[model samples]
Target: MAYDPNNIFAKILRGEVPSKKVHEDEHTLAFHDINPLTPSHILVIPKGPYVSFDDFSEKASDAEIAAFTRAIGKVARDHGLAGDGYRILANIGENAHQEVPHLHVHIFGGKRLGRMLPKE
Candidate 1:
């Protein structure tokens, strides 16, 4: 699906909505998840209008993609999860239950947050 210019993340980028920011650089933005699943749960996103991870990889410049990934690492370290480790997740398409059309990465840690999906 095409990127929705009016999606919530777009609004956050436009400053139309408020978010507790964690980190941001020229090509990316990181913020706290409003409905956080863990103490250090955060959301990372590219500044551009890419609908999913695949879309971001295909359309965004190499520099932008690098910056996005770097930002994620920095945020994890800033939250003190680098040593212990952290979880980064990106949900794409409907089967993954991606609620938002805009592309985003979820960084979760700071505790024993476990089992995103049930054991098979």
Candidate 2:
């Protein structure tokens, strides 16, 4: 998909939109999700323009992805989600229901997060 520069996350990154900031560094930003699934749900994204994991992987540098994942871990640890085990999710493409095209990782925990997927 063609990257839309005006996507919400992009706006959030550019400070055009406000968000409950969680963790931010030179490479990534983490913020509270508007529609949280768990008690402590946060969204992490790279500072660069990336539409999806595929986009990120193909275009981003190793250092960029490293910073992004480290930002995720930091957000998890800072929010006290690391101790009890939290979930990190990245929804890709239309079938996965990725609303915003910008690449992002969802981190959530604090309650008993149920099964990850439906049992077949």
Candidate 3:
């Protein structure tokens, strides 16, 4: 899928939309989720315009990949979620119900999260 500059995350990156930013660096941005599922729900995203994890991992530069990965860790630690552990997840494609076109990873923590998914 082609990258959409008009996507919500793209808008947030461009400062066209408001976000409760937690951390930001040259290659990545971390922010609080508007509709948080946990006490510390954050979203980490790359600065580049990528459609999903597949798109990002396949196209992003080494520096971008490293920075994006580190940003997620930093955000979790900074938010005090590291001690209790956290869940990092990314939804890819339509079947995964990816709401935004831009690639983003959700960091969920702050309480004991049960199983990732119900048993099939």
Candidate 4:
């Protein structure tokens, strides 16, 4: 499938909805998740409107990918999670539990992350 304008993350990127933003660069945007999984949970999303990681190859440039990963690292370090350890996640497809059809990296820490994933 191709990129869709109706993607929820696109709306967030376009400022159609409100989000607790933590970081933003020319290529990426990091914001707090409304339904957080950890003590400090934020979503680092690309502004290029990618539907998922698979879409990254088509929708993002090499620089864009670098920017996205850099933003993720920054979020972890900036929030004082560098030493404590943090988790970065990107969900893809409906089977992967991607509620929003846009690419995003989940940054979560601030406390010990037990089991590293939610119970299915």
lDDT of each: 0.93, 0.92, 0.94, 0.86
Question: What's the distance in Å from true for residue 75, model 3?
Answer: 0.5
> Least accurate stretch of 10 residues (summed lDDT) in model 1?
110-119
- Show model 2 residue runs off by greater than 4 Å: none
Model 3 accuracy (lDDT, Cα): 0.94
Candidate 1 lDDT, 1-120, residue by residue in tens: 778899999999999999999898999999999998888899999999999988888999999999999999999999999999889999999999898899999999989867778889
Those runs of model 1 whose alpha carbons end farther than 4 Å from true positions after fitting are: none
Candidate 2 global lDDT: 0.92
Give the best candidate by TM-score: 3
By lDDT, the best candidate is: 3
Model 3 backbone overlap count: 0
Return the TM-score for each candidate structure: 0.95, 0.96, 0.97, 0.89
lDDT of candidate 4 vs native?
Answer: 0.86
Spell out the clash pairs found in candidate 1. none
Over 34-55, each residue of candidate 4 has an lDDT whose tens digit, in order, gives 9997889999988986888878
For residues 10-109, write the lDDT of model 2, one tens digit per residue. 9999889999998888889999999998899999999999999989999999999899989988889999988999999999988999899899999989
RMSD to truth, every model: 1.0, 0.9, 0.8, 2.1
Clashes of each: 0, 0, 0, 0
